[model samples]
Target: MRWLLLIWLILWGTGVEVRAQAMSRPKNLILMIADGCGPASITMARDYARAVLGRKELALDAIQVGAVRTGSVSSRVTDSAASATAYACGVKTYNGAIAVDTAGRPLATLLEAAKARGMATGLVVTSRITHATPAAFVAHVPRRAMESEIAVQMLDQRVDVLLGGGWAYFLPAAEGGRRADHRNLLREAEKAGYQVVRTAADFRNGVRRPVLGLFGPDHLPYEIDRNPQAVPSLAEMTRTAIALLKEDPEGFFLMVEGSRIDHAGHANDAAAHVLEVLAYDEAVAVALDFARRDGQTLVVSVADHEAGGLSLGRNVDGRGIYDWRPEVLARVQASHERLIPALRQSDRPDSLLRAWLGLDSLRAEEQALVRQATVKPDRWPVVLTELIGRRAVVGWTTNGHTAVDVNLYAFGPGAERLVGSFENDELGRLLAELMGFDLSSLTTTLRQQQPVGESR
Candidate 1:
């Protein structure tokens, strides 16, 4: 989907932009974006990370970092389309245009330049590969919804690696696909010399040729909701993409996105949000593992925007008010999730609702109404909000992208350049320069200490 700029936000806060200062040449560039991940999500991630590691260690906190204003060229409140385009094209276009400039002209992306420079390129996302964030790297579409046509364009880019869902658009309608052209993307990619694969086993055991991996028909399943049969986790894709792309001697530029963070936010599912963030964190670990081992890779993790400004903390109660006990809180969500689907799906929701909630005195419609009121978001249930609506201190805001500054965290060479405020597009230029390309997108300097690997 395209990033939409819905609101014109006034610039707030006190940080000036930084020019590209490449402190060291990185042999490989792994760029990861947690889609719709805003400041609240970052805080939630740190809290979850601290809880999981049983210590205060977030890869984010280690970096020389700063905030970047994530608004699109046209509006302050950015969608993924314009945001991704800004960074990928280095020139912002109106929302929904991909790889095209503000004037609607196609321009080369950092990936294209890298390919021309004999560098390998890979694009990975939990969202469809045709989704705006990934498409901005190589596609120039008048609109983002043209997924079937976008699939055809993938063959033209000659990218070394492509991994994500959206197989429905690759196959024919007769074969349960969506391609009006009726082209078999898998075979076409292979005929073009890519080693196409459809499963984890295929990906893991397959030979290293340029690869096309279509794991699912749309977005990959969320970590907390997926079965191995449907879609692999983001970490699996990351590890596999790194392994395949790094084999090239010219080095590689890899874009890995954790898409479901945005989905969780849209659904206002706090638990799912935290779980997906942790999943992305695992992928982060995968990239960092490769970077540290290679000793020449630069890893930067940033979010395009904030979704569902989240707040998490215990609420007070007693003589006054307080959160239900932890054990009781868990029970509330569990029972509700088990009960809501039947209520929404049953031929007689009111009757079933009466049986489920055990309030026989209530009328059928009232029972149905209560069930509906309990799950304001969607087909699932969450206890976090019952706490919030009751004045408990746990909830999220907006349930949509906000015009908030996103954190830029980096590690490895040139990361020192990340120490202050900067625009998201400047990151595009910095990556271009570090991989030894001239973006002409922005001018940044090397660290005061100088970039390493000059002699190599």
Candidate 2:
């Protein structure tokens, strides 16, 4: 009986492989990343939508495929740079490496391959365009902190569509930005034919082939705090990128990231985390919808790592109660990060807290915590989230990322190829394979053109 079971399992695995090989190649690929989104985050969002929003399902629930193991060469828990590089360059590198190997050698990324093949390429994210995840796709650097250098390389690549924040990296210190070299990359970008748009209106109005849309000086506002008229949502960015890139006869490769979900997690803010994940789900829907209509498009949604070690249920106020009150989160109108300024200025803080947080009167200790966090700007997010999370019965184990595997969801052609467990780099190689390109050859060519051990 044991031998029979083993035989059946082997046959099933073989069948999956055969089907994957038999499937037609996808013409377009959209990789949607929810940074630091763990399994609990999805469940928390699903439950909130069901109980409060009255929705039946989330966009990601239907396409549930498998999971991916995220780890770097240096640590069991991977940072965004190393994990993203795993998906970009098909290599397991030390943390802080952006599309580079352990020896600090450059490796070609999927986006580079697509661009080399004359297909359109794009990167859209809620975080700065020069951040680790997006930077891994377009830039190579020894350290993830080299945003100014990453920005230069990104422009040199000439991606078809670029949308996100971090304009500060492109400007000089004289222009109130972080760049010390005094080089204005934005001006250089314009010279290279990128229509730079800062406002939402400009993004909507612009129809150019190559565009650079920097919506904020740093990371964009969290979803709950975002002003729709001022900044575009992740879904809006994904939709617009697809519209622009799909015009290519060959195809396109676009990466859309819900970057702030990770931030919310690090702060242990259950309400903010829920809102961010919801926004990401909307973006996933946008990609899935496009793939369904086009038939030749592949949509893949994944997470680099799980942050905050969030647990859905916990004892409230140190009581033995095991119940979780997701309704507590539903009443939150704004994120703790957004409420800091108003909180610092408000004369009647208790009154403001009750209104904004949808809470009754707060305990003296909770009020004291809020007041302390208001004065200390760096502590505001975690302090506020603690107060809200206590009420919601959600608990966080750590402020940093966890080593647990994250879920993978997919739709469209060759998705079945990824319907099982994968090491992060294996997933990257599989994506390159599905695209019918050789990343190794591209890496060789790129290495020959550039000197080894090059920094910045």
Candidate 3:
């Protein structure tokens, strides 16, 4: 036995055996997207988790193999739709494209290919199920805003598990929904044998295969504003999706998105951003735990782009020194979305000022800014964001996405494919290869196909 072990070690050490071992395919793939979570955003979240939440380390920090360039075909800074398309379809499309090439032609996505090869496919997101990120995986459209059409395509694709918000898109106009066609997609989904779940209870109780869960009318509430009784956490949705998809012996492909991290970043709300990242990290923990136990799964976590150009440390006292106050961030009780509505509803801004700011005492100037924000409906978010950033020691360059390379973290079988720097589109090709799919054939077939309204 000792001699056999020695021979195995020798073989492993040799370049020949190492190459073969590294080429091994993963039976299952879990692609987790922390939308707009860049390096600085991650640093702020990590520090806050350690200082305030008492966490020793984040699951994401453990498996960070390297960074990946996130440029789209149309722009250096990519949007959620285009980046997701690149990750899902092995091609770089325009910013608004969803599972389509730059010419508006449909592209066979990773989930479609996985399903074609007898693998169970699932999508779990904190955003609308038909939103850009998740839509890119299974739906082909010229624009990401065609979510109602995306919902139809989702059903057409026969995805095994569909979970997240966007209930409005599924319901018809007659049912007080945003759909223009008056077609009740929820009924159509039910007729097609999906166990549709709407609330937290339904999600927990409806544990069967072919489950469809839409928790909110739009994107689910931010983690800081979420009610546990009404909505499920990202971690909960991840576990449920894994449970359903893993039952397939042929293996599975699942995409989970921490969708609202981008929104909080856009708002430049540092407290809310950290909370969303922590929520995303919890989902990461779930995936890592499952991958470790399954051993045949490849778990990859990445970001689409960097939003807000977030900087962790702010200049303090005009002394050229930077500082971050985790305690100030810890005092935040609600998200900007929640606080804004409350401010609008309440006539007494002065009484609710300090509590809403989450600070024990606010400077006179800060108090004056908050008072002005409450009265000035147009400048409310900007002023509040500034107040939050000043107190928490966070700084933002812009309230939009930035052209920055995002970090990539991977573990388990085929994790080697994710290491080192590469274009965002290359990730899709690597993932296709990892799943043992012929990318050349898939691309050729998809390109040959024309758009819905285009004449051949």
Spell out the clash pairs found in candidate 3.
none
Cα lDDT, all candidates: 0.69, 0.91, 0.87
Each candidate's number of clashing pairs is 17, 0, 0
lDDT of 1 by residue, 22-140 (tens): 33678788888888777767666676566544657555566637777787777788778777877775666677777666755565677776777788999988888888888888776
lDDT of 2 at 50: 93
Quick one: RMSD of model 1? 11.9
TM-scores of the models, in the order given: 0.79, 0.92, 0.93
Best by lDDT: 2
Clashing pairs in 2: none
Q: What's model 3's overall lDDT?
A: 0.87
The digit string of per-residue lDDT tens for model 2 on 1-456 reads 999999999999999977766566898899888999999999999999998899998999999999999989999999999999999989999999999999888999999999999999999999988999999999999999999999999999999999999999999999978898999999999998889999999888865879999999999999988999999999999899999999999999999999999999987878889999999999999999889999999899999999999988776656755677889998888887778778777777667888999988889888887777667756666677778878888889998999999999989998988999999999999999998879999999999987777754
Q: Which residue runs does candidate 2 get wrong by more than 4 Å? A: 1-23, 345-347, 364-382
The lowest-lDDT stretch of 10 consecutive residues in candidate 3 is 447-456
Q: In candidate 1, how many Å is residue 131 off?
A: 0.7
lDDT digits (tens) for residues 1-456 of candidate 3 = 999999988977797765865557889999999999999989888898889889888889999998889888889989999999989988888999988887777888889888878999999999988999999998888999998889888888889998899999988888978899899999998999989889999787766889899999999999988999999999999999999999899999999999999999999888889889999999999999999999999999999999998987766445433678777888878888888777777787656656866677778878778778777866678877777777777888888999999999999988876889878889889989888887567757766664453422
Least well predicted 10-residue stretch by lDDT in candidate 2: 373-382
Prediction 2 TM-score vs. true: 0.92
